[model samples]
Target: MSSPVKVYVYDLSKGLAGQVSLQLTGKQIDGVWHTSVVAFGKEIFYGPGICETEPGRSHHGSPLRIVDMGETHMDEQTFVEYLSQIKEHYTADKYHLLDFNCNSFTNDCLGFLTGGSLPPYIKDLPSDFLSTPFGAALRPTIDAMFRGRASTGVLTPPPDISATADSSNPASASSLLQAVAAGATSNNSEMPSSSRNYLPTPAPTSPPTPVQSNSLTTPVHIATNPSSFHNVLHTHRAVVAFFTSATCGPCRMIEPVFEDLAKSKSRANDVAFVKIDLGVGMSNAVGGEYGVRVTPTFILFLDGNKTHEMKGINAPELRTQVDLLLYQAFPPHRHTTLSLPAIEAIPLNAILSSQVPNLDIVLAKVTGFIDAAPSWSGSTTKEATKQILAKNIIPYLKARGSSSPPNTSFEPWKDATISLVTNLSAGELFPVADMWRVALLEPAVCSWSATKFGPGSPILVLLSKAEGAPRNYSLTFLRMISNAFANKIVARELLLSSRSSITALMVAALFHDDATVRLAAANLAFNMTMHLQRLRVEKVRGNVEGDDVGENEEWDIEMTSALLEVIEREKANEEIVHRLTASLALSIRLSPSIEQLASLLEVLQAQKILKDKLERGGCGDTGVVKKEARKLIEEVAEKLCS
Candidate 1:
């Protein structure tokens, strides 16, 4: 059943404020009241500037008027999730008094909720007020107060893992630990609380070994000495150490508590849990660092800094303090979260890897026919175009494969040859079998690379020349080949068999200054990368494998690095973001080393690509691309941290 959604609007300037506004601008205007969506009696509000969304609170006081937007097919939870996405993109930082403000937020919500926007008068009020000379002079004061109120009225909620990219709440240490612990051992089953009642197990005679817990929980490392504890702290981004003496009765009471905390939900946060024995005979140096002088002491370190410490016999207090400290250390933000869906790997079958029968003869016949054509005759040219388009030549090419097509011999028939390749690519079912055969004969033609084809590839050669029909045609032909890569079989052949040289050439083309060319290249790159990534994912899952499938199937870093370089070099290029997003996503999936991931993040941060996601007003495919890219980046960061 459809649910009722209402937009509650409050007019702050309805009284004296409206009078003042009228006197200043010769127009009667009410001060702005915050807007929120209410469903099932619960109000959903977003604070001014880019802030996290919370239920049951409004930065702006009570609404003066509530307008019903009618029924929505979406349920309450789904609707709120949608609002969260909007909040991630439409940040408070981008709020402008005359442009984007609270009213804009309301309008967007209304549009999404009811397929309509607020009244035009209300939506245009701020801009209209700013247009007058008197209002223009007062703009500075108005904007300052507006921004101040937005900032001051915001009420930050406790850390929620679902917080959007702009969440600023500081999570408690325990929360952070729980998050980290959850992330680390998510694959394993949880160890029962009853099983954790035992005393600390003595260290082995040899070096410390990882304890294989039956439950899926973060590993609890035992530090025999202070130095070992220090090493554990250095290894994890967040660490919680349980310092206890074996003889202490209170330490025994809370031993199970520490173990339970370690096994808390989601083991993906990557936090480390350590147990250090500070018994009578143990080293005191580590305890001295944390100033731990009491038995059953707990110290929390975030990013190598001692953030919190507590000592007590009460298990609740111990659990509370740890939770507060860990949350503060790793305040979870949705912006950096990544969703990596496992793609089942596909094993190579005979049709995919086996050589096409008689392809060499077919390629030889097509090249020979093109080479024998008389370029000087218009009638001959017309006939050649007809034959090429009619599929008369395709049969021979499919029937017999050639070692090498006469690339140079077809200098006079360049246009006709390009047309033939373009037409073949445009077919409904991409003739992967024939296309692969043709690609093997002229690898350069597969990527439409000018350098490899030289004068023989007329379209590509003309692309580097002055802007004219040639450049346009070059983009057209490139688009066709790129489209061919969208086909599963074709993509597999290029990525696995030909070894990705074609993919590299396509990526290199993104460096071009032309917006159209760059967009086409990006689209092409998106298709190829997605196809290759899917195959890679399948390989990872053991769902797909072939004779040539390498054991370690990683993303093409050369292509990825090239894409990153392009993203870095072309930060200002409006058309490059989509392509950059795809390339970076593909690179992230390829599982680059830690250093490589860090480098990619640094470039993204420096270029403000991730930061720019907070800005409003991306439309159509560009918006969709940005959204996907943002998700991929979050996943990349998550994987790197994990």
Candidate 2:
């Protein structure tokens, strides 16, 4: 059975915040919200590290509001194990009032449990508070009050709480489970004290197990056998193995340094640091295999082959070699060698529109169109289409705009939309296209549509039909394409497998006689460029999995060609020019092969076209968009073309 999750919202300031917030921050605030996730009969929160209690039994007393956070299909044991893995990241020392606090913890837990997040008003309060002058002035004071109060050891539950079976296994569960059994059994009215303490030692029969891969920050892997030693080297791209013995004083001295390195670097899956004790069972044979004659021997392995070795306890050398090993294992992107400051500063965040249109009016218009059409007269298809729109699509779109709506089955909607678009005339498609334009803003809907339909999705088909249709149909179609960038999955499809068709549509729309259609096309172009740029940034950070570099390069070249073609034709609209230039700048800057792109720019004489645009300003020349465009264009020219 799926467990129902809820967010318990407490007022940290009691009643004082609501009364004084307007005077202090120049804004009327309701309450100082502190949220906690209630799941599996326990109330889990973070403050002085991850803490727990019975629902509504925390020191904050009853919640002012309890937001229903849907349900989690995750099993209890797996969820407990997940918490243990993230416990170190939420330690008491890491907590901050305006930063990593209770709300942040609950937000993360809710997302993990149900793929949802806390409401914007609750999660965004800290930034809203900090944006004010008085709040900014009070930051240091707030920091001083909460700082230096970190618990010295593992956080323990309050005294009234009894340990659960899951709590006994600290290796597999975090302190969040400490009160589950007590909360389940107790009926006391008195709340437990919200104090931080150390957990009592477990029974001797239940010996603490070594930390596993789940907790990479605590990196002490005791390799007792050769297979275990080789396994670490095999799994990780780079391995730093420290051979140590109990008798060596130098080994004891440098062990802490090795651990610190492991804590810093081991979080990435491709690197590992293992400490092999020669004195432990079967560890001596593993040491002998590597020809280790003395204690404090370090060996560096890359791709399961020993590459470098060091003797004695030299912390500086060990640090230097480890850095070199990682540098060699994952080489930096070639773009890092460039001197393009302006391009490097470009924000890669995707431009997504979240505005929800008046759904009632949209539904009325859609149903009205269907009811009035002679094509729908005396047919069950008319009623079925309205039912799907009113019952399934409209409610889903409304709920999805505000919260993580349940994953309602979209197969019916998908089949119905495809069928309608395939059969409907271009003049009759605006209502359906407009509804989809709004629905595509929701990432789940966008992703589902892309996956269900592949290259021949209804949206793409609508775009094809709307090419020469009326302004309303064409504008709505372009807007729908622009909103597809809000979801990465569909955005990637538009950039990759569906690139040729989308490129043709965008190129044709860019030269449209209608300025609004051209502007919409430009906005679509910018959104696609931004998505590709984001992937490039992620690739540089080593966070992106798979081959984003090749895909980005391919899209950059093709998008540059398309943008350059339209730039010469766009004469009057500074808005279209601005978007086109911005998209071009993003595509050209910090590219994997800047030299190749510069060569392309040279071939196309992009410098002259951009310079000519600057010399002969737009028709209504406010010069703001033109000036920003020039700054970005000049940066590109100086860095790439010059």
**Candidate lDDT (C-alpha), each:** 0.46, 0.64
* Steric clash pairs (candidate 2): none
Tens-digit lDDT track of model 1 for 232-334: 5655677888887767888888888886676441132235667766642233556777677888888878788888777777778867876676566544322
> How large is the C-alpha RMSD of every model relative to the true structure?
27.5, 15.5
The residue ranges of model 1 lying beyond 4 angstroms of the native Cα positions read: 1-385, 390-470, 496-501, 546-555, 569-576, 590-609, 612-642
Q: Measured by TM-score, how close is model 1 to the native structure?
A: 0.30
Distance (Å) between predicted and true CA of 170, model 1? 65
Indicate the worst ten consecutive residues by lDDT in candidate 1.
Answer: 208-217
Report how far off residue 406 is in candidate 1 (Å): 29
Candidate 1: Cα lDDT at 373: 44
Instruction: Write down the lDDT that model 2 would get.
Output: 0.64
Model 1 score (lDDT): 0.46
Candidate 2, residue 590: the lDDT equals 53
Q: Which 10 residues in a row give candidate 2 its minimum summed lDDT?
A: 207-216
